[model samples]
Target: MVRERKFSDEDLFLATKELLLDYGYEGFTFGLLAERLGVSRSALYKYFGNKEELIMEFMMYELDQFMDKLRKINDYNRFEDQFDYLLELLMNHPQIHQLIEIGRHVPVNNQKLKEKNDKLDGLHLDMYQSLVGFVQQGKGEGKLKPHIPDTLIVGYILQSFLVPNFAQIPHSEWVQSIKEIIRNGMFTDDH
Candidate 1:
């Protein structure tokens, strides 16, 4: 007889995200997830065939949440405000970048996995599309340089998140410095 599931998906995904961020993909396992959820490993196995499947499922949830938050970029009227919001979101979810990189290691040996991977790639493009609109608006308003290509500007801003806070500087100061560099050129204004 099929036993009713004990945990809600919110609980499952929440636990999955925490574990994934804490231990990362290499360290994450169904046993760990089950233990975190206070359930038996067999209970998890009944839902997911293997660790990869469970991870992928959790990733889908994660991406959806991210996209929802990304959509809020339109809410900020000012170009700098939008840029700051995006940076804050990226900072708050730094693990997302690492998790996505780890996703490439997921073995897409079956149709389901392939489709999920494909969907993730598509979602990435969707995110870029939203950012492109933001960049285009900035160019139109003369807030961003028109000479530079939009793709490059978008790439620069997104890649800026990967910059390390090597000096262990305070958070607000570091973010402000990054914002200054992103808005103005690295050189002093006199240049």
Candidate 2:
């Protein structure tokens, strides 16, 4: 007889995110996920046809959570506060940018995968638009320099997450350095 599912979809997605981050796309496997979740491979197959579909679904769920958090940045009154909050949020999810990069290259072989990919693309666009809106708000408040393009600022912020941690600096110090570089630029005011 087929066994009932003990874990919810959210639990599976959370575990999948952890595994994907631990082992990149090339290394991730259904067997590993099933093992990690304490379920058989057949149990996982019931929800997703293949690894690609499962990963895509997880990406969609993650993006949804991310967008929800992004929208909440407006709750803060000051743009600087919002910027700090955004930075903290990004720092907390170190693997998200990598996952997004992987998602871009994931092949969509079937109609369902195609539809899911389109939805993921839409979520990505919404996330970008939310960032642009945040930038615009900062500009309106005269906190962000009007001379800089919104896309450039957004790109810089997003790419900052991918900065190499080769030095093994403390997380707080590293994040502070990033905030300083992004907000103040690399040049000293004394120059």
Candidate 3:
């Protein structure tokens, strides 16, 4: 009979995110993960063959979490409400962007890792589909300007987190300011 794992996948994934963020992909190792999970390296081996498999699994968890929350944007009927919800959601996932970028660099030497990487790519497209739909909805409702390309709008909204917070503005205000700029141009109606 197989023995059960002492730690839950949720616990392991949480620790994985923390450790990966603290120490980059090259620096991350099973020894470090074992220490974080308070388990022996051999214990982890029972779950994954190597660090790559574990990291792929962890990325899957992250995508599932992000996609779950992203699906909720449909709950809000109004474009403004959807916009607000998305902004707030994006704010909460500040590190996710970086995490996803890291996932992109993970090498896929074997079939399993390749499959996981392909799934990750599919999920990314699904995310873009939702975001594009959101933009299209706004355009259809006259909430967003029709002249501007949907790709540009979607790209801006998606990359908003990349803007450096060098000014040290409060999070709420910063997000609000970004919303205003997206809704209305910097020059205002007068210009």
Candidate 4:
């Protein structure tokens, strides 16, 4: 039987965040984390049991932070402003962007990890829905074309935000271009 070990969840979270940032998702591992913490392999195992749990924990932490940031933008009365804020938040967290990219392509062996991914998917779907609601609102206010479906607009915005090769372009410039495109293409004439 494996003995459980106690470690600071905050420490583990920060360690995992730094590891994912430094090594990216593909290169991050428990052994590397243990080495960083100057702990033995067994000690690391006692704390996390496996890498998948660590990754999921980190993902959840990031998701919570993301939602919190979104919630704080309650003052933005316009959908375009909210969308721009969302883009800005994502652009600032490129490591998380990379982690998500890694998560999408990597295969997982555990059911819990799969479930966590499902939950993450649901969370993202909810965010997309919120954005679509804004788009629908814009349509009602004659701020967007009624002909364009909400799903397509949301999907396009997501694709623009989550591109795999974001490291190549300066994020500020990319964001500006994205905002410009979204304004010209999606926002209503009043924009």
Candidate 5:
């Protein structure tokens, strides 16, 4: 009789995400993943053909989790509350943007990789729609200025995640300051 697998797909995906973030794509290896999961390298190959397949699957998994949280923003009655929730979501998953950047360079040498890239593109469209809807709602509710374009608002929100902290500010303070800057312009009322 065949033995049952010890770890679930979730277990593998979570471990892969951590390793990818720490080691990046160039450094990531099946050996490291197998060692981290307490499984043999061949055992991993049974699930994924190679690192690219594993990484693609992992990205899909992470995107699903992210989409779940993003959908919850609609439950809030106030745009301000939704905006705060959105900030928390983005800040909590700072590596998402990095993962996306990594995905850009992910070689598509097979049909499976092409399909995965197409699916990822669909997820990106869904995310963009959700963000646009949120911005539109904020504008209608007067929480966001009418003159500011939705694309600009969304871009600013996304770019905020990449802002450098050269001053070594505390995470809490940095987040709070970012929230303030996003909500209120940098210039004082006197200006």
Candidate 6:
């Protein structure tokens, strides 16, 4: 007979994240998770009562990390620099992209999952607002052109990172050039 293996909270959390990335929210289940770990379903229940609870926990953990990074940015010279830094962070997180892709299919049963998702969404919205606020501050400080509205500034910043064509450019050079262009358009005074 084979001896049973015990799993800790950290083990469960890591397994849950990996399972979610592989199978997505709709496809993942306690039984599936247990099987993946070569454990019994009861063992999974001990850590997570249901799929919704597990998913919410995972999402909240990721959201917390994202917020932490946002709070730590202090040295950038301009809003675009901040935006580029954020873009680089996002690009490096392949797991986050996978989780986001999986999130779209997450099942909504009880209000808890929805509540957690709503909270994460609110954080993302707050980040966008911060980006807009940064641009507004830049204009007031004369670091950015006054003609560009906050909305356009934020939108364009996101577009540059999200759009595949420009996304290919290396993070460092892209950020530097974008910051320069945002402050001063192509064709300088000497041109």
Highest-scoring model, lDDT: 2
Q: How should the candidates be ordered by TM-score, best one leading?
A: 2, 5, 3, 1, 4, 6
Question: Number of clashes in every candidate structure?
Answer: 0, 0, 0, 1, 0, 0
Order the candidate numbers by lDDT, best to worst. Answer: 2, 5, 3, 1, 4, 6
Task: Report the backbone clash tally of model 2.
Answer: 0
lDDT of 4 by residue, 1-191 (tens): 97554556777778887887778777888788777776776776655557776677677777677767766555687766766676777667645545666556546677877887788777666655666776786787787888988888766665666556546777667778777787785456884
TM-score for each model: 0.77, 0.86, 0.83, 0.66, 0.84, 0.60
Q: Report the alpha-carbon TM-score of model 1 versus the true structure.
A: 0.77
Q: Ten-residue segment with the worst summed lDDT in candidate 1?
A: 94-103
Query: What's the true lDDT of residue 88 in model 5?
Result: 96
Model 3 regions more than 4 Å off: 1-6, 164-168, 185-190
Residue by residue across 1-191, what tens digits does model 6's lDDT show?
97655876667767888888777777788888888677898876666667777777777677567667765554676655765676666555535545655665666777876787788678767666666766776787776778867788766655544435444777667666755665566668896
List clashing residue pairs in candidate 2.
Answer: none
Model 1 lDDT at residue 65: 88
Give the C-alpha miss distance for residue 120 in model 4, angstroms: 3.4
Candidate 5 stretches greater than 4 Å from native: 1-6, 164-170
Cα displacement (Å) at residue 106, model 4: 6.0
Deviating ranges (above 4 Å) for candidate 2? 1-7
lDDT values for all models:
0.82, 0.89, 0.87, 0.70, 0.87, 0.68
Model 3 global lDDT (CA atoms, 0 to 1): 0.87
The reply for model 1, stretches above 4 Å from the true place, is 1-15, 18-27, 31-41
Give the clashing residue pairs of candidate 5, or none. none
Write down the worst ten-residue block by lDDT for model 3.
182-191
Worst 10 residues of 2 by lDDT: 93-102
Q: lDDT of candidate 6?
A: 0.68
